[model samples]
Target: MSHLFWLDLQNLKRIQHLFPKPRGVARSDDRKVLSGISHVIRNGLRWRDAPAEYGPHKTLYNRFVRWSRLGVFARIFRELAQPGPDGKTIMIDSTHLKAHRTAASLSKGGLKPRAIGRTKGGLNSKLNTVCDGRGRPLTFFLSAGQMSDAKGALALLGSLPPAKILLGDKGYDADWFREALAERGIAACIPAHRGRRDPASHDPCMYRKRHRVENLFARLKDWRRIATRYDRCGELFLSAICIAATVIFWL
Candidate 1:
């Protein structure tokens, strides 16, 4: 395994227990299988291109697909991503990833909307995330690139730990959303949209910290696979995102 995976032996031990024991011949070389997963996400390499050190590329690819379907990576992310110190405030934001054409073509029986959208950037996907006060990711949601930032807002909010204040840009300033936050006893610190009939009030000082979520996105994109979409299946791509978050952010 390369030095890329920061999770040490102890952390690895903690992570290993999350999955039920793998059955069959594929169960061997679990460590290298995981290492190969990390490698592919870090380098954004195709399964066939994974280095020999990680193990056979076919095994790695099959393992990744199996894990994706089983939500193993997502479980790892949830278990490891500890809540940030300032739990009272949650920052929400979204970023777009340019999807390669390889990710656009689907088999005849494939699913629709795969979270890819046509945009000024061509084919793209939206990655919406919620971060804690210190910019640690709490939850993530993916939608088509052209989807409004607020499209996935409720889903992201639902996954977050209870927080007192929700910070966001003008895009999240909808009346319904504010009301939704209020119902949970959370203060909406989102800036009012320019076209609002009556502008809502928010603390400007607190809003400045919205940059923390932006910074989180910047760090996530540092993973080449995340910077550019490659997987045709949305679930697989999301699994990749979870792997990156667990290894790079949570670790």
Candidate 2:
């Protein structure tokens, strides 16, 4: 068997309560199934390529897809990412994920939001995130790759945690966004846009800390599944991201 990653007992215990209880006939072992799922996602391998020790590849794939559709992974991530009492400083930013060609097809009728778009760099999706003072992810939003950073910020605005200050790059430097933050009693440490007639003043010292969110993105992209989009469904892709964040940063 190839080298594989498994959730140790401690980490498994952290999320044990989040797994749904089995009904009727008992299902396969949760640990083995989850480990197989993680292995496939971490290595960006196809379901059929999973090693045997994790159980039949079909079991791993079914468990992941079923749980993702049920929002089990999202709930786990949310529970794990709850803001601490001292989470006063927060950061926001976005990163793009390149979509594989196989990800182009959507289900018939297309009611679901694909979140994939064609940019000069081909098909892509954008992940916008907010992280606490220590760079732990708090919440995130997904959008088409062509969406503007300011727009992405707006989408995540309501979900921003309670914080005294927010750190962001100039991409978030809009009058409305600053006004919104002001209304929420949060200070913005964002630099002014190049074309602004009245440049906004920001503390360069505080702005330096904005790299924490970038660092968070760097760590998240280390998961190959997250670095490249393969799921045709946007929710499933976001679930993959949430699972990775939970295991890597929260667990």
Candidate 3:
């Protein structure tokens, strides 16, 4: 039911340009990296527990890190992003993903606040993600569970310019958010937060269409990896989300 997974390999050919180099010394091509990374996400397995076909767990993890540090995943989203000058609408939302018990970044105190906090879900991490009108992710952010959905909107939506419209819910109704996008000429359609004195700026019809973001979460959960945070580092967890989004985008 997800457009990304439902897309065929032939349709996914466009992705080859982005993942030209496969991870691992023994891996021969990008296909291996794609498969190796995809396998981990779909099954929610540990990196060190990657299957034999993936060459080495460290290799896959290293490659993921190298690519992430270099902004490869962000580039993929930028290049493959749908809501262009001639495309459909855009939507944004965040979802909480519970970290694995033994996940590295988890700790009750010290510097692990990035991974541990209290949300409605108790101890968890929140994935702030952007998607097109049809539920395809365009960008994402990984913050502590206590982080608000509105916290990362500026970073996520500010990156892309030249769009007809953007969508969101009551969580993103900030005056600066409107001014931020207005400066770039992007139509900020986020709904008003509670107790907002200013009138609403979003269209109810288009706002209803924001359900695509929820559907995107549903599809992403199909990949157990994203459903749970097994990675200790936020960077690694985000990389997995990026790769998973890529797989879905290309699907």
Candidate 4:
């Protein structure tokens, strides 16, 4: 195994407990695929030069695609999301993704109003995330980047415990949104809306950690397939994100 994946793959192979390597022989070189995956994640290879030793190229790619669709990665992400002992305090944020031109062509272009907008950047999407105080992602959502940050924030926070406190920016300011969180017994720690004479204060001490979501975005882009939007189907793009999130959660 290459130095990149020796330990990480040993554990993953153990957890996975199955999945044949290439050629249907007793191939134990699962580590090579892992290292190749690291190569793709770190260096953004085109997937053709994934290294010959990682078994047949098709085999390794198929394995990654299978694991991605099976929700195996999503399970890993969920396990990574550990609420504090108090089970409270979450931060939510979103990131933009500029779709490749090929992706724009894949759009069915329908009554989905949010899908019809465009910028000089071509089609865009948002990767919304909610994380615990420790900066682990608990929930994530995908929408057209043209979508309002707050429009998606509510759905991401909807699954959180009602008693927990949630923090975000002024974009989340809305009487209905606040009321929705409040109704769930959640404290909307976001600042007041713009132009308000006075607004209640939240704990800057905690809000400072909101950068976790940003950092998560940074880490996710490390995956080549995700760093640039390539998938044409929205579901496949979202699946790629879920898989990437799973990879980070485990690490």
Q: Against the unseen true structure, what C-alpha lDDT does each candidate score?
A: 0.84, 0.91, 0.71, 0.67
Following a full C-alpha superposition, what root-mean-square deviation does model 4 have from the true structure?
Answer: 4.1
Enumerate residue pairs that collide in model 2. Answer: none
Worst lDDT run of 10 residues, candidate 3, spans: 1-10
Question: lDDT per residue, candidate 2, 85-195, as tens digits?
Answer: 879899999999999888876542467798998899999999999999888998989889999999999999999988899999989999999999999999999999888
Of candidate 1, the 10-residue stretch with the lowest lDDT total is 1-10
**Lowest lDDT block of 10, candidate 2:** 103-112
lDDT order, best first, reads 2, 1, 3, 4
**Which structure is stronger by lDDT: 2 or 4?**
2
Model 4 lDDT per residue over 139-207, tens place? 777787777887787667657744478888878877787788888888878878768776667777777
- Relative to the true structure, candidate 4 reaches a TM of 0.78
Shift of residue 122 alpha carbon in model 1, Å: 0.8
Superposed Cα deviation of residue 87, candidate 4 (Å): 4.1
Q: Give each model a TM-score.
A: 0.93, 0.96, 0.78, 0.78
Poorly placed runs, candidate 2 (over 4 Å): 105-108
How far is 14's C-alpha from truth in model 3 (Å)? 3.5
The model with the greatest TM-score is 2
Query: Candidate 3 on 1-251: residue-level lDDT in tens?
Result: 22112334674587657764644654544555556767877887777888776677777777777877677876776677666454446777888888776663434444534454566766678888877667777777778888776677866865554566778887888887777777776687877777767766678887888888998888888889888777766666777787777777645
lDDT of 2 at 102: 81
Clashes per model (N, Cα, C within 3 A): 0, 0, 4, 1
Tell me each candidate's RMSD, in Å, in order.
1.9, 1.4, 4.5, 4.1
